[model samples]
Target chain A: MKQWYRDTGLQARMFLTMFLLAAVYLAFISFLATTGVGTMGIVVVAGIFIFIQYFYSDKLVLWSMGGKIVSESEEPELHTIISRLCQIADLPKPRIAVVENNVPNAFATGRSKKNAVVAVTTGLMHQLNHGELEAVIAHELSHVKNRDMLVITIASFISTIAFFLARNLMFFGMMGRGRRDSGGIMAVWIVSILVWLVSFLLIRALSRYREFSADRGSAAITGQPAQLASALMKISGTMKRVPTDDLRKVEGMNAFFIIPAVSGSSLMKLFSTHPQIEQRIAKLEEMQQKMEF
Target chain B: MGFLDAFLGKTKLPKSKTKDIFAISTANVTFEVNLNLRALNKAGICFKPQASSHFTQARAEVEELLAYSCKDTNTGYQITKDAYGYTWIVLEDPDFEDLVSNIYLVSEGLIERDFGEQLLCALFTFKEKGGANVYWIYNFKHGNFYPFAPKANKERNSAFEFRLRSVMEKELPIEKDVERWYPLWDVPV
Candidate 1:
């Protein structure tokens, strides 16, 4: 019996979410096997593409965000803090990157622990205090520890194939990507479209759950749940005044962000890549009260 | 966590490990004789506060015990709230052995009370021949000791600290990383 506790039920929730996604992928594959050989070919091609993406995701995402990996000499304070947090998290020291923007956001990107890169915006550094910054870094390191990217990438593999098939079929006028129109072409197109839509939602939901798990992980690593919760609130509050134009620019990478750029209360709540700030903060505050006393 | 780590059920092993601080008492002889440093006869234990009653009770008990135990040792202890919100149990005694024993008692009491993880670092203040300050900081989290000799704001006496570390390496488990020699700036003596 341990004296302290935080919410790791989020881990089980992520697993269940992935399990549901795996089931959906299994059904899609079973349906595809009945359709034709073209579907299997698409699967093979998607696997290769996913493998490439996984290997170079850290570089690709950093490039896309105009982020650069910094050396220890250049950002010794950042490196020192991250290494200390990693020591607590029991993880390898991941590369630290910095993005020269004012959006007040931070993210972790990589396919595995060894290949992880944690990037933060300049605004975040200017905006948060030491404890807040440390808490945010702990959150990013938690994501690396969780390997949420790898889990989602594996989940997305089959969905990407289905998406490739569906999009190409739509472009090729209901034909199977320059292949002979088998009688089951109509069925494959419908199944592909359904799989694409459903998998997209499932991945988003899993992503949200993983965010919760990472929040919990950060609290555990730092042993200061309130610090993380306050940091989230600070970031989210700062995010609102960061100019909607700037927010929209990187909104595409919302899934990888500490706090998404979305404003208050959107219609896309169900499709949100991250949980609501209020919900996350409430959970953390509850954890703080329960675990501290 | 990796799939293998999860499969092996290795989730969340204890993050912090605490080592015996009595080593410092033995190492004091080497530091004084070899490095020409003498204990200022002042030591302090730092810990982060928790809101738990158990922690509060343990802190109260430790303070009471320290007060009672030091009544005849010509030693005095002070409780200070540092600027960083970390609480310090500062002890002073002309006899270095009494200071070390007092710190050991407070630390052991906290450990027995299940609040050991909250213990941050134990500081044994020492002085050079010319009255320069050097600290042997025992990191409770990492279970290692380090020498911190801070000169003005954020500036470190790196050369001297490194030499002290090299001299004391065999006597104590010196923290290998220079970055982790977290300087206790403006620590209330």
Candidate 2:
């Protein structure tokens, strides 16, 4: 099979992030065991949380975004583009949905490739050209192909436990009257907080790297990195003029969107779910340059 | 995709799978004898064009090579772009074998130039006794064939398409998932 452009830097960074995440999680679990905090309770809670999330994520995401699943007869152009991309990517056709907002964004969500759904906002359909729209949908399909939903869900397992422990441990510490066990509870609370904070950063980093990987996948599938680059630019450009109220409604979904809804804060790069738009476009331009050769 | 690739967030596009396209030529007899469908002796290979100078130059050379080689086979061909921004290399020949081989040539030429991902599908036209148009679409990416019967106003005759699939499934590499049976509206074959 012919290979597209490669990015060792991104791959290495992703590897390093996963390694650190695993290390952090292992240490957190060990700490919980030593502190005599019932790890089973946290694990069961986290498991239930993830199970619900994994199974119903598509429905929840679409409903939250006000998306409507459109039949092929309703959105023939959209369906055709998705069909071609899916065929090229060697994926099962995913359900196509359209959101009514004019936010110029799109997302993909499902537990597995077979049950995935790719959605676009009406504002996005009106904003981009045919090539740009295809490019954006290709990016979303890449997310599905790479199992971003599953990866992110599993990666956050420890974080979810740590968060739950952190909040409840503090409350338990406050209620206890004795200093002997109080000290142990305090130690566990501090450890849980540390684990949660560290894992939070690592998860965000992992998510951003996944975005870069998905961008590369989009380029590989469509053979048009420039089109995706332009789509990102156009989406972000229009995102600026969109009403803040409109953006606020969908801000919680920034992690899954092609471009984060809120812009203009460079300091938020580390915490943001997606990489900076400029950086993403630069990577895509690099692919475009390599393809020219 | 392999487990390792998914774990590493790698999604390389599948290689062009045009080898199974020849199954259509062999199945042509089944269509004529059993289904009352006659070959129109016309096929179109559709591909997406990259916005790169390299692709444009490679395409020019490929077209020149195509024209040079088709002279002996007497296969008529023309290049056209559709409203959806896909390019089509339409081939015409009375012999079904020639039409099929020419479609392969176009796909092979592009794949050799490292643009296999750009190759979409090839449409082979067939006509019924009632003058309705039926097409056997060979998806190059997935290497599966599907039936597309278009009625007026861009409506599809699903019943006829399903009938074609039933008859041709044994002879051709028919696409099993009907969802991948994408309709190519305004196909200029």
Identify the leading candidate in terms of TM-score: 2
Candidate 1 pairs with clashing backbones = none
| Per-residue lDDT over A1-293 for candidate 2, one digit per residue giving the tens place of the 0 to 100 score | 23445787788899999999999999987877777544466567778987897899999999999989999889988888888778778899899999999789999998999999999999999999999999999999999999999989989988988898888766655555445577777788888899999999999999999999999999887878989998998997843534456777888976775644556575688799999888999999989988876
Write one digit per residue (lDDT tens) for candidate 2, span B89-164: 9999998998888888888989898888888889999999777989999988778899999999888999989998
Candidate 2 segments whose C-alpha is farther than 4 A from its true place: A1-4, A172-180, A238-267
The window of 10 residues in a row where model 2 chain A has the poorest summed lDDT is A171-180
Model 1, global lDDT: 0.76
B1-189 per-residue lDDT for model 1 (tens digits): 457433211234243455557788899999889988989989998876655555577789988888888896778989998755568999999998898788778777777776665576789998988868889988776778899888875578989988987788888988786756666677776
Calculate the i-RMS of every candidate, to one decimal place: 4.6, 1.6
Q: So what's the TM-score on candidate 2?
A: 0.90
lDDT of 1 by residue, A118-164 (tens): 99999999988877788788788877776677777887888898898
DockQ-derived CAPRI band for the predicted complex in model 1: incorrect
